[model samples]
Target: MNPEEIGLEKPGRAYFAPDDLNDPALTRLIFRLGLPAVAGLSINAVHHTINMVFVGMIGAHEIAAITVVLPILMMIGAIGEGLGVGVATAIGRALGSNSPQRANVTASTFMVLAVPMGIALTAGILVFRRELLGLFGASEAIMPLAEHYLIIVAFSVTLTMLQILSDFIAISEGNTRFSMWTLLGCFALNIILDPIMIFGFGFGLAGAAMATILSQIAAIAAYALYFRKRIGTLHLSARFAAFRADILKPVLSIGLPTTLTSMLSSISFAVLFTYAGFYRGDAGIAGVGIALRVLTLGMLPVIGLSLGGQAVLSFAWGAGKTPRLLAASNLLLLLTSAFCVAYGLGAVLLRYPIAAIFTDDLEIARIAALTIVVTHIPFIFFGMRQILVVLLQAQGRARLAATISIAQNGYFLLPLLFVLPHFLGFEGLLASLFLAPALTALLSAVILFTTLRQLRGDTDLPIATFTNTVSERAS
Candidate 1:
């Protein structure tokens, strides 16, 4: 069948081939798919950094308050992200299996589940705002500011969840351009409004929160409209209310690991910050905060690339196109590793300038600069680990994915933090943070190679059958 006959148009003169891993035309196709997914994810990291840039101007206290609250927000948002990843992967697989009804069911189920959970999360945050902030090591001085920020953000949880779900839907349907536009537009709006609300209206920390919520609301609207018109067939059905265990099982399987991975990082940061506070006081926490924000700015785009790899590899796996899947995985590793190496070197070299943009205080900037140089040097392997995890999840190997998740967060990071500080002191703590992720990357590589070898032996599966199933389901 012609590409047009299957609802896919050739980008150029070359005809489409499912197994064309080495085709120049196919490489371009993968690039086209990967770039927008990268952009979509990067927009999220951009919003966080931009928010930090504005909040940093207010003072260290404001920065600390935001920092303390960030993990909680991420923990809460992890629920949505975890679920969204599951939905995206499942939808892609269903599309590959030529089960359009099942794909729609997956999409609809995500929406139904996300809304009530978001509402409950919002209410929980509002009711326990003070208590939650206290657990994160918030001081009396920072408590009020954190409370203000948390309340505003909590109320907008539904909008954020909706936007995330919509983005997943777009990516699953291979309409990443639409997802990218939604994120970019929201990011631009957030940037434009942050100054006005924070400085012009003197909203302080609350202003930043307001800007974030408003931007998310706009994104939600845009995504909703776009998905209804141009993306997948995600019509709501009464069956979604029935709560099919079979449908939700895969989502939860994938989502739980993803959530734990994020939560573990949040826990690690919280512990690290608390330790820094005990040993170094507010200055140390503020310094670490600045360093983290800088690191995020550098690492987020690589994460974007890894996410792109996840989407492509997951779809390819679902389609049983082992060659294409391997190609996509290797391409991501090569490209992202190169990017990380350059970024790590540049961060070390230009540490001062990057730190200075956040604050004028020479002491904080110096500490931040030093920390950035130390922490990011090991991130060269971080992207590879992330890509492998995504690949495993796409293939529905939840056990392996969960094990890697635990290894990265629980097994490696938590233990390192406890043990390293005993002998090395503060330096040990810092070293542990870097070492954990680097080790996680190495372990992930081993697992990926082993898994690929096993898949190679499974000779009964036919790639064309898989591809046809996906195409039929997607349509």
Candidate 2:
């Protein structure tokens, strides 16, 4: 697992071990780890926006088709992301506790588990494609397009899930550099294939899907070789892939909340689409969808920063290095808060231009810009909420993590989704996006301030023990 073999860094730097996470230069480590996570993850997430750009050329209806599919795509990816978080937490804790075997088992086991679940998800989606698509707000015109894109997407869900899981496994061991290269490889290949396949090959919407799966295939090969060539510490060999209940429990405890959080967020998108469709039509749906994608691209830095910090946070928390964990949390929140403010303002100012890039329809572009302004107005407060959710998860406060995870999308957003639309009509629905996170952040503040107060002195007190949140419930 030499860094040289994987092209991560020069030899003196050393591959990240659990102990290596204790580096006193906390700011430097965050940037070193955070930058790669941001680059790789941002690239992966941005490709979807790229896909929408190419598909937007076909028509608003085609854009609408992809829009509706976006929720379902997020739902599937949510499972992988959630599980990957679980894997990272478990392995991070294991390595922090100096248990290499435990780390090995967690990586191998999840790698094996994720693929079959991906296959199952694909099967189920394919079996009930019409029902699922309609449930997500697909109209007749969009249904055929959605199916065309979805059939190919369904088959590759397995690969997508594994790709996410693989990235986290590598990151968990502090191998973010490997994670970065593999994702960058996927991004570069996707960019190359998209235009060629969409127009050159005459595949249209289906071409985008083919390009995605093919790029994913290439990324998967890189991960396989990383292990096969002994470039990473954790091995995905056959013997360790066998399931064990002990491994499953803790992972699921942290992961289930994460999945629920992401699913709730994904479901919110579907519900938003449903309402947008009901109030406006394909145009409104297209408009809102474009706005959301634009917002997603804008927020990638925030997400990347959070993930990079998460790896370090989990490692420090696991090692019971309270002082380091405390410092890391402080810096993470500050950086997140600062970045969100800057991006939110820029996003609002540039809304019209950003929306214009996606579609030629003036109606769609206008609606998209309006949606962006409506959604981002309250973005300043959300930074705290996002970082707190990561902090809670890293601390293994599963119940709190799950609660916060859904705070915006579920507790606040869900009721708003239903009630607001009924009262204020479509404007109310759009308002819900602004209101949910804004409200959630205020509440997040209460919880966060209390915890920060408790650890104010950073005494050598073993940061509170982090057991599975499920176990807390059972007790």
Candidate 3:
């Protein structure tokens, strides 16, 4: 153990080890884990933007169809996210607590559960494709395009789930760089294939979905290859027989809330979409969709950093490293606040230019710009609050996390969607998006502050002393 004792890649330089997390400089550790994730997510967001541009080129109708279907697609992703985050948190905590055995078990169990669930989802979507889209308020004009896209992409769910889980597990093992590379490779492949599939092959909407499927397949292959090299402590193998309740419980506890939170987002957005359709038809859907896609570009970095922060916080919590936990909270607040200020200002200043990227229609672009400016005004508050929610999950405060997640949308967003439009009309619909996150942020800040205050007074070993002891033991 000591840094000196560990072998360097070359003569002078040392690569980051999982044990480096135990180092006292919590902020450096955050960047080491976070920056790669941010890069990966940024590239991923760019890839999506490019994909949207390609789809937009198909016409306003195609883009409108996509917007109508976006929430339902997000619902599919919600399950994968829940499982991935849950397992990742479980694995990270296991490693931090020095229980590699448990981490491996969690990984193995996840594969067993996730694969079947993905397959079932694909089958179900294919069977009830129309009903599912209809439930999300897909109008008659958009339904055909939605169906066409889902026909190809639905089957890709298994691979998509695998890719997501692999990325999260890799990050949990402190191998964020590898995860980043895998995602970059997929993004590159997706970009190269998109035009060829859509225009060259003339697959249209189906072609875009096919291109995405192919890219996900490439990502799954990459993850499998990387995991075979076994860079981390969590190893996925054929251990279906050794499945234990203990390993499954922690993963589910953290994951279930996270998954439900994501699904709620989809649900709330779908409800908003329904109202939008009632008020403004395809134009409303197209405008909101463009704005949301643009907003995602801003969110990618924040989410990447949040994922990094969550893994670090989970490890620290499991290791009983209070000072490191406090350091993580402070650093997340600083980083997110800075990002919010920068991104929010950019959104406000370049709202029209940003909206114009997706569509040539002046009406859609104007509405999109308005949506961007209004929704992003409280960007910093939303980003910090999200990190706090993830921290709650990482620290085994799943009930609190779940409560926050549910209330943010269910209690706040849904009611706004119904009431705002009646008074403010179409503008009220967009305003609801802004109000929900703002209110949720206020609530989360209060809870996070209270939690940190309690922890500060607790009789736990300080991070400085803990780091010194670890160093001495290593030496």
Candidate 4:
């Protein structure tokens, strides 16, 4: 079939058909896939920021309590996030290669597995709860609140993984709208419930946790409803749940690097929080944590673009459509890089105002503002590296992706975390955040260049000839 003969959306179509991935206008296709992913993520980040704001009102130490608990939460969420990425890549490639049964089985198998993994994690975490709290820099004063928050939050793990898998599977098969609504609905419910549970019912930290799980429950309900409708390409069912080494291996290989990267971030943040607590006490820890949250919120858009772009890239790769892959890579880089530069400048301009939203304490706000300046601004350049990592994953080049993933935090940030603090005190802790991404971006540039060169040679032609290769694999 030619590009014109491929599946495209009809007026009454509920979602884009799998093969429709190749024929949509590049800009429309990328954004149609990307925008909702970013919107949900950005709003969710807003929820966290606002949660910090609500928590801030209780006391600075409560903020400190949250600061300490976040890394632990991230560590848990990373499992779902990482696994979801793996599932998405696998399914997207499978569909592009015209294997719907593989797509169906992959979703069913992973969803079945996610529940047990989440349950085991919750059990393990609760068993080791206090130790983890202390390990992440929860001081004696913050420990009770952190523990209080975490105990309630832990039970949501199974549901969390379920929701993530459902959302990613939906996204992979060209059904991002429902996934977006799931996230947005969860965000709405959590926000509405946060104040009610925290202040109205006087649950405090426990209230926030209650609100979170309730929102997650609602999200899972929504996903279940959507999946039952069977509007999209894949139908997830227990009938398809049998394990196959073939599916699990590629999924793990593609996914674990991302999990490690997120975990490394959690570890680095834990280490940073410890330093902040040592140098600046409760206020510093809260301030630094707040800044980091802001940094993540800011990166959401571009990160969303990169991930969304990855689906497109992976589809093209599996179809052996050289020009579509190159077009995707080019457009993604252009859009993400532009947004990052613009957002970084906005970070510089609004640092104080942004930080002030999370806390009333002048010292914490000032510290957060300074951190935004030091951390958020330079972190813009990471957009380049972020896109590169996702691009590599899209191409199913796990080794290269894993190497880039490690370079981000493991090689650059983790080493710098200890070395810099030993030399320059608190300032150095912040400096590590700034420098690692910069260095990683430099390294990723070399890799990106080399990867592109290899792609050109592998395609058996130069960049100019890729455009003619679109129908090369439509068998």
Error in Å for residue 356 of model 2 = 0.9
Residue 312 local lDDT, model 2: 85
Provide the TM-score for each candidate, comma-separated. 0.89, 0.93, 0.92, 0.93
Whole-model alpha-carbon lDDT for candidate 3: 0.81
Q: Could you give candidate 2's per-residue lDDT for residues 138-196 as a string of tens digits?
A: 99878999988898899999899888998888887777887887888898899899999
lDDT of 1 by residue, 51-128 (tens): 888898898889889989988988877877888889888877776655667878788878877788989988998898
Query: lDDT tens digits, residues 151-207, model 4?
Result: 888999899899888888888876666667778889999999999999999998888
Instruction: TM-score for candidate 1, please give it.
Output: 0.89
Quick one: RMSD of model 2?
3.9
Name the weakest run of 10 consecutive residues (lDDT summed) in model 3.
Answer: 10-19
Candidate 4 worst ten-residue window by lDDT: 10-19
**Residue 62 displacement (Å), model 2:** 0.8
Which pairs, if any, clash in model 2? none
Clashes of each: 7, 0, 0, 0
Model with the higher lDDT, candidate 2 or 3: 2
Task: Evaluate model 1: give its lDDT.
Answer: 0.76
Candidate 3 or 4, higher lDDT? 4
